[model samples]
Target: MFTKILVALDRSPMGKQVFEQALALAKATGASLMLLHVLSAEEEGSPYAPLLTNFDYYPGVGSQSFEHYQKQWDNFKNEGIQLLQSLSAQANTAGVNAEFTQQLGSPGRLICQLATTWGADLIIMGRRGRSGLKELFLGSVSNYVLHHAPCSVHVISVPSQVTQAEEAPQETASVN
Candidate 1:
């Protein structure tokens, strides 16, 4: 019954699964898909300013550094653009009407805003399955979206084995 489905892509290992699920849902429901990827300022550094504050540099060196950061920012955004384009192509190839947006902001806030702006009836995304103190400390975009999204949210949880493999510490055998 969903006419517009928004998929929030985080580019995590779980991304492929999330896209596949969203694509399938859209196909089954004959819904158009909107793929959204947010490039967080904290993750990519601020785009409008150099991160190195309180520093003095030789003539032209400051400009060079700022240019370097700007190049990095462009590359970061380009990567997101390429990813969204690729995902959109996949959906289009599967006969689903799909469009994408790559924005810079808080992921949760951006996703909710886009969902409202796009009139999405359903949102599908992958959850890292963080809980307890780890989730509290790291914060959870999925959790925030679930609470604040304008539409229904479907969170595909990461598998336990995947979580364990990523988070579990290596063990060493004791010498007798």
Candidate 2:
């Protein structure tokens, strides 16, 4: 019954899974799909950014200025745009009406904002399956959206292997 379905994806392997779910839902409901990818400011400006990239730092290299960080952020957004373009192409080839967007900000907040602004009837996203204390400490994006989203949220969780691993201890304890 959804007219507008918004799917939030990342470059992670789980992105394909999330897109598949979104495409199926759109196909079944004849809904238009909006694919979104958000790059967190914290991630772009993190101290470990250099380590994450191929950039090598010399011991006496100049410190990173504001302009440097700004340029890096721009590059990150460009990469995200490219990824979204590829995904959008796939969706289009599948005969699904799909448009994609790339935004920079907190993933949870941006997702909710876009969902509300775009009047999305449903939001499909992938979660890494973090739970318990780890979730509490790390802050689950899906959890945030579930509580705050304006519409129904469908979370395509991580693969069963990860979920099962996370639940192993609980499953063992329950049997005792």
Candidate 3:
């Protein structure tokens, strides 16, 4: 029975799309839903290492120094809680039993860990997420969850907005 389901989300187009699909499925199935978002750890190594190793950034010259942002640590954690709260509220309105979880570390790993902790019988997520290249290089969250999660995994593939627009018919050559 898919009584427990976990929906992974993040601040990415694919993440949002998967969340929407999961929500709908949760409603239809009368399944309890949980939302999980993971924050990456602070690597002592060069921050650019991740970008350089994974992303499609231009090698040397394209890299630029970032103006370091000093943000409140507690506030940063609270922001994650707030996102979970907001997501939970949406589920609440839909009459789904729901909760939220936030953890720090590799996203894919955290997602799998939370699925275990939450005792979710099913997990639904986007095929690609915020960290495309990094995930591609080190397995996407969905991919990891598919192999590692204790439950069944659902990967939702969504077409990009540009693809949708391109598929739409041309407005018109009006014949007056």
Candidate 4:
């Protein structure tokens, strides 16, 4: 009996699965979708701003380095926007009303805040299997959202094997 569904997406492959599940649920429940992508340096493909050390505390290491970092950050934001637009399009094509927003902040906090502000009835997201020390150190966004979200949360757990495969670097075949 959900009226509004918020789908939190990242750049990972699991993001596609999360969107698909949300779309299916929205279609079935006749709920509108709010696709959200949170931009953070911690996310893959996002560039970290150059740190100012005691040795050189002007602005960054150099203006060139800062400029490069800025370019990468812009690209990361643009990519996130593109992804949200793509997902929204797919949902619309499936006859599900969909809208998207790309914001900069902690994923877990943003998801919960948006869910509350948007009045979402449910939040659907994917969780990369993280546990023990890793979970403690890095923190689990899904875990935080589940406990803090104003609405019900459905987490799609990505298998450990799948997560490992996605993390591994791809090999290219050399043409002889």
Root-mean-square deviation of candidate 4: 4.4
Candidate number achieving the greatest TM-score relative to the actual structure: 4
The 10-residue segment with the lowest total lDDT in model 1: 42-51
Q: How many backbone clashes does candidate 3 have?
A: 0
Per-residue lDDT of model 4, residues 28-75, tens digit only: 999999999999766767786637233246644677776777788888
Off by over 4 Å in 4: 50-60, 164-176
**Candidate 4 Cα deviation (angstroms), residue 58:** 5.9
Q: For candidate 1, lDDT tens digit of each residue in 24-96?
A: 9999999999999888853423364544563354455576687687798798888888989999999999999
Estimate the TM-score for candidate 2: 0.76
TM-score list, all predictions: 0.85, 0.76, 0.67, 0.87
Clashes of each: 0, 0, 0, 0
Summarize candidate 3's per-residue lDDT along 92-157 as a digit string, tens digits. 998988888877778677778878877888888876432445645655556667788887889886
Candidate 2 wrong stretches, greater than 4 Å? 41-72, 163-176
Query: lDDT of each model, Cα atoms only?
Result: 0.86, 0.81, 0.69, 0.89
Model 3 RMSD, rounded to 1 decimal: 7.6
Native-to-model Cα distance after best TM-score fit, residue 12 in candidate 1, in Å: 1.4
State the local distance difference test value for candidate 3: 0.69
Q: Rank the candidates by lDDT, best first.
A: 4, 1, 2, 3
Residue 82 local lDDT, model 4: 95
lDDT of 2 by residue, 1-176 (tens): 89999999887778889998899888888898999998863332332244434334544334465457667667777878898888888878888889989876688999999999999999999888777897887788888899999999999877778788767775433554
